[model samples]
Target: MTLHQQTTRRQFLQGTAAATAGLLVPFASRSFAFQSPNERPVFATIGLRNQGWGITNKSFKFADFAAFADVDANVLGENLEKAAQRQGKKPDGYKDYRKILDRDDIDAVMIATPDHWHTKIAVEAMLAGKDVYCEKPLTLTIDEGKLIEETVDKTGRVFQVGTMQRTESGQRFLQAVALIKNGRIGKVKKVTCGINGMQASPVIPEVKTPEGLDYDFWLGPAPKVAYRALPEMREGYGGGVPLYSNCHYSFRNWHEYSGGKLTDWGAHHVDIACWAIGASDTGPSRVTPLDYTLPVEYKEGYPVVDDQYNAATQFNIQVDMPNDIEMIITSEGDNGILFEGTEGRFFVNRGKITGKPVEDLESNPLPGGAIEEVYGGPVSENHTANFIDAMNSRKQPISDVWSHNRMLEICHLSNIAMRLGRAVNWDPAKREIVGDSQANTFLSREYRKGFEIDM
Candidate 1:
C-alpha cells in the first residue's frame, strides 16, 4: 500500500546496465516490492478518462488496482470512487503520473493518455519496473517508437500496444494474417487500407481552462496553448474537436498530439498489412504521397491557421514495402483492408472477411488451430488478459513494440511525405528519412522543456 520513491533514470540504468539477454530469465529476473507466491499483480493507470478506465475495467480480472493518476482531479476522484466501489479497495490518487511510476507495489500500468504522452510514461514506467499496456498509436513520432523499443529490451518489461485488431473475436484479423502468411493469397502484390480521413474542424475560440482540469499538464510534451471550450458539433468520429492543443477524444484529428487518421486508424490497418507482408520489424524503402489536401494552409509542414484543424483530409499515399509489395493507403472506401495477390484477393474489416480464399475456407480451410497460430499462440480472452499472461511468463505480447514500431514508423513516414508533397526514400535500418534534411526533421519533434523523455 506504500509508494516508493521515484527512481532516477541514472539509478535505472545502473541497475539494468549489466543485465544481458543470456542472464535474463523472464518473470524471475525482475525484482518486485510485492510478489508473494500467488498474489495477483498490482496495477495503476495514468490516464483516468474514457479509454483509461475502459482498460482498467478489463484489467481488474487479471490484476488488483492500487492507484489512479490523471491531470484532471475530478476524473481521478471519480475513477477512484468507482474503483473502491468495484474492487473493495481505495486506490491512491496522483495529479502528476510520476508518483504512480514510483510505486514498487504495482507491477503494471495502463497508459491511455494522448499520443504525445504515451512514450514518456511508458518508458518511465518500465524504467521503474512496471509492465505497460499503452493504448494505440503508441508513439507521437518515429523517434519515440525507437526509444520505447530500446527501453523494452533494456528493461525486459512485458509491453503491449493497444492494437485490438490483432486479437479481435472469431480471429478475423488473425485469419487475414494467417491467410496471407500461408500463401492463401498467392504473392501479395498490393494492399489498400481505406481508413477514413481527418474530419473537418471549424474555427474554435480559445477560452478558459476548466476548473478541475490540469490543462498544462495535459498538454505535456505538446506545445502550450490557452485552454478552449470545444463544442460538441459532430457525432461519432472526430467530434468535440477539442483545442488542437490538448484534446479529449478529438486529438486524433490533429498532428500536434497525433498523426490524424494516418496513425489513428492506420495504426491498426497498417499494422495488419505489415504483419501480412512480413515486415513487422522492418519498414518501407520508399514512401511517396500522391494527391493530398490539407485542412489548413501550411508552410514548412506546420499549420498556419490557429483554430482550424491542420491534418490532411484527402491523401493517397504510396508505400513500397520490403517484400516487393506496394501498399496504397488512402482516405476512402469502406474503412478496411483489401489484399490483392497474383492468385486472388480478399477484403476484411471488423464485420466480415470475404473473397475466394475466405470463401474457400469452408471447403479448403486453414490448418486446424490456425487462428491461435496467428495470435502467436492461444487466443486470449482479450488484449489485457494477454498482456497479463505475458507479464507472468515474460513472453512478448501479441501486439509487440518491435512490430508496432515498424507499423507506426511507416505511418509517420506517410504523414511526413504527404506534408512535404514529395517522394521520400526511407532507410528503415537507420530509422531515418534518407537524403532530405527537411523530411528528416519530421521524424521527430522537439519536446517542450521539462517534458522530454529521459532516454
Candidate 2:
C-alpha cells in the first residue's frame, strides 16, 4: 500500500501531519525534500500508551502515521481513537508489531514498547528497511547493545534512540557537557553519578491477565508468566508493593523487561553522566558493586516477600576509565551527577545544576554550535521531529543506536555488578565482559523458544 492508500479508520485514529494550531505542521513545507508524493515516509508506532503518544504527537509534523500497534487493546484503543480524531483518517491497529513492520508502505517505525522488546523489534524493523526510534535504555543487555550497534551500521538505515535530554533546552545537563568540552570545566578528574537503584517486583500472587490484552505478546522475549497488577505509580511501577500502584508503569524494576530504576532513570541520568564526562563512545573500564545493609524482611500486603528486590537497593559502584578518570556511582543520596575537575566540582540534575566553580546556568553563554551540534544541525522542534527529519533524510537521528548502546551498557554493567556482587572488567573494543563467565551471563539471556532474538 502507498502512504496515501494506507490511510484507513485506524490510520486516521493514529494521527496525521496536516497543519493545525497547537500542533506541529508538515516538514515538507519547511523545505525537507525527502518526502515526495510517492515517498511520504509513512510511519507506524508500537506501544501507544505513554511515551508513544508523545512520539506520535510530535511526529505528526513530519510523517504519515498509517498504523498503530499495541498488545493491550484497552489502553491503546483510546490512543487509536484520539489519533483518528486528530488526523481525520483511520489507521491500521495490530496486537503484534511484527505485522506493522512487515508492511511495505511503512518507511519507518517509532518503538515505545517495554524495554525487553526493544532490541528485538528494532532489529527486525531495521532489517525490514524501516527506520526506527526505540525508547531509551536502548538494549536490555550488553549483548543486545552490541547487536543493535552492529545491526544499524549493517542495515545502513536511520535509527534514533529516545535520549531526548540532548534535545532539552536551558538545562545544564547538556550545557555542562558543552562546558567541559570547551575546557570551561578544566581537566575532569572524576564523575560521581547518583541514580536510584532497581527495586524488587511486586510480591502479589498471579492474577488473570486483563481482557483485550495479549499477555503473551506483552511478555515478548521474556519468560511467560501470569499477570498480577504490575504496579503503576503516577509514572511507572518501581517493582514494589501493590495498591493504586497496581497498573502498567513499573516495568523498569524487573530484570526481564527493563533495567529497573538504574536503567530506567539511568538511561536519562547516566546518559548525561557520559555526556559530561566526554565518554559517549566508551564506558568506564570496571564496575565494582559496593554492598550495603538492607532489610532482612519487608512487609508486602501483610506477608514477607524476603528480599524481593533482586536488584541492589543500596550500593556504590566505581567505574574506572582510561586517562585515570574514575566514575563513582552511588544508588542513594541525590539523583544526578557530580563532576569533579582539576579546578572545581559541579553537581547537576533535573531540578538544578550547581558547583563550586561552574558559572550560573543563566550567566554562562553556551557555545555557538552547542545546540546544533548536539542535534546534528539545527534542532528539530523536539526529539520526535528529529527522528522524522532523519527518516526523510535517511540520516542518523540525534540519539542514534551507537551512542545509546554505549550509554546503556553502563547501566547494564551496574546491574550486573550489583547482582553478581563484584566488580566486572570490560573490554570496550570487543564490548564484552573480560574473562568473567558468571558476569557474562548478564550480557544476553536465553530466549524461551519462539521469542528468541535472531541473528
Top candidate by TM-score: 1
- lDDT of model 1, residue 218: 90
Least accurate stretch of 10 residues (summed lDDT) in model 2? 22-31
Please give, for residues 1-455, the per-residue lDDT of candidate 2 as tens digits. 23433331121111222322211112111223332444455789998867888778877756678899998887677888888887777678898888997788787788988888888999898888777888887878888877787888898878888888766534346556766676666788888878765444455456666678787878878877667653443434322224422235656555667756668777887787777666778877887776642322423211134214334456677888766888877778888888888877777776666764455434655545653454345545567666666654567877777777787888788877766656889988888899888778778887778987655
TM-score (C-alpha) between model 2 and the true structure = 0.83
Could you give candidate 1's per-residue lDDT for residues 26-56 as a string of tens digits? 1111122223323566789989778898889
Q: How accurate locally is residue 1 in candidate 2, as Cα lDDT from 0 to 100?
A: 22
When summed lDDT is taken over every stretch of 10 residues in candidate 1, the lowest stretch is 7-16
**lDDT, candidates in the order shown:** 0.79, 0.69
What is the model-wide C-alpha lDDT for candidate 1? Answer: 0.79
How displaced is residue 94 in candidate 2, in Å?
0.7
Q: Pick the lDDT winner.
A: 1
TM-score of each: 0.89, 0.83
